[model samples]
Target: MPNCHCFWSHIWNISGGVGEMGANMNSIIEEERVRGGVFKDINPEDEDQQPTVIESLCMNCYENGSTRLLFTKIPFFKEIIISSFTCPHCNWTNTEIQSAGRIQEQGVLYTLQVKTKEDMNREVVKSDSASTRIPQLDFEIPAFTQKGSLSTIEGLLDRAVAGLEQDQPIRKATDPAVAEKIEEFIERLKKLKKVEEEFTLIIDDPSGNSFIENPSAPQKDTALTVTHYKRTPEHNAVLGIEEEEDDRKPVNDLDTMRNEVLVFNTNCPECNAPANTNMKLVQIPHFKEVIIMATNCDSCRHRTNEVKSGGATEELGTRITLHLTDPSDMSRDLLKSETCSVLIPELEFELGMAALGGKFTTLEGLLKDIKDLIVSKNPFMCGDSSTADRAGKLELFGQKIDKIIAGEMDVHVILDDPAGNSYLQNVYAPDPDPEMKIEKYTRTFEQNEDLGLNDMKTEGYAEK
Candidate 1:
């Protein structure tokens, strides 16, 4: 085991690590970094950031190898275990990451477009619990089918090719016809790696821990789309969320409690203490019913609220464009659904739907939130002097938003929601608002695919 021991000392030993490992620790991050939009616990390295090593059997050769495990907390997120094993006899290696704590509050879906050669190099974090799909190929890798990977988009394709090719010899020996068809499909998969055609890569994670690197951060990238939504019952079941009997489940007595606040016992997200969450179903005058949730934690003095559309996703997408021409427009109440995206062409700004999370707020309040989220809280604009050009651009954008709030700027506020659940107030009441135009358009095939409707069979599924 002398070779095995030396190889591990080159990798697992932080105390007396090789120069290559030390160089990695000192490497500077060159990517354009932005803070505030992302919430991550860096888990800074300290004197005791070391892995526990143990001797284990290698899966490849059944020979003894050293396995190392490190338990790290993402904080407010879950505890995660990073484990790696290396076999000396076969020169084999295995690495995996596992969630050791609670599942996220909502599920996340990421859609990335691979249009160029550089796009294939983008990093991706594919959690074991996440599902991967490519719409063009009609290929799907179901959840838990593969170990969690810390790799680039190219690595994912390479792994897929390897898995398919591994069983080809057996398939050819037993069933040549089936093997021929598979071989053709395998060639198609290989051609995809050439970037000859543009394709979509999707990762759907019920646990909300998977991510595709956003090479352009703080600014929107046209090729990437991320959406977060409340997990469905089936998704919850898969995540082990619905298995436990809990009082936090939605109240079963909705009919009798309609117009009354229904309170549920839950834990505070911030403090992990006992708390009460109140939910009420309210009908908007021109819009559908929406559920409002408010939470209060006496132990930690933390209070928060969020809105959720009470209706199902509509058959078509809704696009509402409101021209701001008067100061009164700022007072209009707006319901921004979790699946809604907001855009202002005048400001050159757009807000995507992911984690858009339901918002019951006034036009003025929403504008202020946009300002605070992008400009006021931006790390580059706050104190980073190196990115003065980037900061100047953000500061100018904030000023224009302020002008719009004051009615000095006339801009078109567009809400494009595929779920068709958002609404903007009409001060004219019974009469049509002259300044607002609403359109309902059919969702495209791609939109339906992104929303998981392509695989859904809602009607006559039992008969099949």
Candidate 2:
């Protein structure tokens, strides 16, 4: 058997030589190999040549060697080298692939729906830094933790099944019931590879080094959809490119305080006792806004917090309305600025900025929070006859909100923001629903005057 260290050194030298010589050397090698009748023709001379394979030592065993290194160029992608090692003496084998390319700025995601045998035969290139997920099965192979491989869809599923079978947690599970469930999942994956079922395969690569080929649509691979997205802070950390933490002194350092306590000796609204209030000015850099947060009543154990924005006032008023249909819409992101108001006409409830203050929550979360608040304040509605009628209405409203959240009832949500700092997220872009309306209208005379819009007019200006 060949020495494992010597074989790896040779492999490194070959890779380094290819890097130094460029495509010219690759062409020469391809010509030489073809003339020697080594490999079959894979592409035209204008395209990249077929892969070159070299024998190497079996790292697993020193007695028997059956290792090979295959270097190939992926069409429209970078050069990749695949290494496979098999030990006849120990019956052990391993395969891995590495890409020789610069990291991409934007990450890529490929979503493919596999429904036929041809789909299973499609080529898949997964980088070690990429993650794979099957949404239907709720199974995921996390990124930066798996080996890179050049395989088919069927091969990928087989690998997943093998991985699940070898999983230590599932094997040594304390609950036999959980182990049985895992075993059942493994069987399902095996059946999926056999084309007995359909599944969606999602590959997310932060490095943007992975790919899946579509034979039918060779040029563009229209069978699979590709989406590019900016890498998150966590991805930056994983890639070791995170920015250094700021070490400079903060503007509001406690040592150089104008006042030790901004609003101290204030009486608690709940207990009517002398309470200390601490005020801190915070800046939200992303939104380009400043906020003042005050926490009061540490002494009476009746704490209350308030947030006020110090940003520039908005001139144009905006209103947003959304008709809730799918329960999935409840997960949409929401940002309620300090000057925004939320209204649910179905529930006959309107919360002004002064009432609910500013908050960031999902639609369902906002509804549940409001329901809980109403319940807390109207405890007497459950027992007092004087408030019984109002309590019944409130209870009915709560039930309707619940039904809406569960996708059983349809309702409308409206947000009015004079400051134009509030936002309603649209789950589908470029195809937004007509029912979800966002209108910008002229503010009333009192609203314009309050915001100093009236003072900006010329002397002879008149209402349009």
Candidate 3:
């Protein structure tokens, strides 16, 4: 392809209201928007006025055809370029969507529960970089395997099923056993389309542009969960990002990163893919400093982050509690150390120390993670090993956790760290938050043993 004008740059400059027109950029763009809406196809009736229709060589028939490019912006999102190629001679056609802006800073994960046929009607903007999966069926649609599409959820399934069935006839003639297994699997997928049972649909997009429509609008959709997190080195590679030597250096100490973040290159344990690890040292109010380490892996779509106390272990353990009296409290930042125990006295629920490893997330996010790990990731959900009674109980537990995350239930969240390394954000820094409490207690000998403090000698052993 020949080099052309930078599409995004042109859009930005035009929107900036520059050039001889001397007209307000917003006014000009708004006029075009109201007239053209989001996108428009080249109308054959306006042959003389069509700007995007250009003669192109068709790959299928090696004949001249036409390609049209449409530039538009999604409401509340970024600018995008849409292209369509048509070959009338061979009846071959293709459409693709690309983001005109730079790659997003974070990747996105969307989980939707397809419980009813109506859920399949949701609009989906799936970029080529997005991966789709159904956890129940253990089926996946790999990223970049197909071109991008602006289609509905049902349409996506149809496309995937069609692709899988395309080569089955040839395989059946060549290998009977493999074909039989695939035929069985395809039948299962067909059953899924009929909504035989509820299944979870996950869209993992490292580019952060893919979207699943929400009919609820401003209201929260209980059936869908969306999470945005830092991207990995592999993701950057996929997006054609250049790497620097400084990204691999571990010389950056706690103090250096406080001023500016330092990213380090690492390998993901899950897929051995190039990943990115980040460390930040944060000072807690009326408390000591702690280090938060995060890692992202694009290959396996795994996100891992941990938090450790920056300061030396204190003589006494620490316990922190916050009363969730309002919905805003769910947005507060929380740090749970490797040795922290979580509890909700009102819900009669408790998570043992280090059960979830270390995490630094919001109250709502942590609760949702707990629910997802227990319910959707449960191995029993995959086969007949699980009884309906057991599944119902787990479902109820997830609902209760969701209610807590939604701030519909008033409760006290407690964090107890035997190492005294955990911290919770204080909205009122100078003053005490009305519904929060902190206390220190001497660690029990058992707790010390569990923390490996029993073999430690804080004082000098050189005399020995």
Candidate 4:
């Protein structure tokens, strides 16, 4: 099996070996020079500092000789190395490209309309991980399926044709009807390469490592349309920067845990009516976090429920699990933060942070609130026959909640607070309570990132 170098050398050799290969390389260099060539010298005045060009054994023709490797940089794009090999014996030639910059945060896509022959001269930097496509031709070259190349629009099309030619088995196995279609498609691509047709070329790179030069476009705008998109979690995993779990304890001030104030008259922020506000400072056992619960209400029926943290930023998150075995458990105080995620595994119902605001209530009150919210406000799930099946499931969930509240069914309540500000009554509290489990675990990198704590810096700046 001949390597890429051998394959390329075979190509040049078949067209006439060293003499022809030299002329081809020279033609490329001339074309580059005519179009304001991108390669630059770090120290042009000193011959000693001339661009470093190294020779190494060609992976494709190791038995023959070495290839040439040139290190250079282009304006806007930095630190790129080009590798080329031309075996004298086998007349095999090949070229490859690589970027020496740091990985990007998001992927990039470049779409260009090939309207003229000049467009074919536009430089393109395609990383090995990028995919190329010609939408008009219904053709695609998947990422990591082809060698990275520093080439022009024509070069890209040529590569595509080469790839198709290499897939002989697929073409041969195709039905007679489709085989002609394939041939026509290949011929159309060849014509496009020769600037005989206009088409659209799109390059999608999840690594944000590819480029399509637009030298003629204005400084603010380019002929190419560039689109950036967030990489999926799976893509991030491959980049070796997968978020780690946050594993730090909350900063709880035990000395501040004193319940002295009862209630204060205030104006409701919602209706600006006279209201009474109740406040309580309670300690979260084992988790070392303090929850400040506030409840406000007025005669106008305007109500407010909020929970604030009395401790420093916590490194680890908190999770509370409660088993409602008796009706008495319904009366237990529950301080849920706006950031807390509530789940009832037995009932197969869960409420995310976006579902509702924070609340200072009991387990039964929380369930009742959820039930009302789903039954009335969530018409998207209950109003139409399109969701008739889900409506039935929701009804069943409401019934389960009723049974649990009536102490007729056993159900488990779980609250996960990545902010570590939520609270649930502990079994070992100063006052005797039913058996409930409270577990604290470190938050994952993704969780901390979501909370805007991953990039938090506490030092090097004065307090305002």
Stretch of 10 with least lDDT, candidate 1: 17-26
- Candidate 2 Cα errors over 4 Å, as ranges: 1-59, 62-67, 167-176, 218-222, 242-464
Give a tens-digit lDDT track for model 3, residues 348-454. 77889878888878888788877887789888866978989889988998888888878788889999998888888899987988899999999999999999999
Off by over 4 Å in 4: 1-46, 49-55, 59-61, 167-178, 194-197, 237-464
Q: Rank the candidates by lDDT, best first.
A: 1, 3, 4, 2
Of the candidates numbered 2 and 4, which has the greater TM-score value? 4
- Residue pairs clashing in model 4 are 8-93, 9-91, 9-92, 9-93, 10-92, 244-445, 245-444, 246-443, 248-315, 248-316
Would you give me the overall lDDT of model 4? 0.69
TM-scores of all predicted structures: 0.46, 0.43, 0.47, 0.45
TM-score winner: 3
TM-score for candidate 1, please give it: 0.46
Total residue pair clashes for candidate 2? 0
* Candidate 1 off by > 4 Å: 1-51, 70-80, 243-252, 255-464
Per-residue CA lDDT of model 4 for 309-421, tens digit only, reads: 66665667888888887898888878787789999897777889746677767888988888888765666664454377887877777777788889998878999989877
- Give all candidate RMSDs, comma-separated: 22.3, 26.3, 24.9, 21.1
Report lDDT per candidate: 0.77, 0.68, 0.77, 0.69
Give per-residue lDDT, candidate 2, residue 100: 53
RMSD score of candidate 3 (Å): 24.9
For candidate 1, write residues 238-271 as lDDT tens digits.
7777655555545466664575798889999999
Which is better, 1 or 2, measured by TM-score?
1
Question: Using alpha carbons, what is the TM-score of model 2?
Answer: 0.43
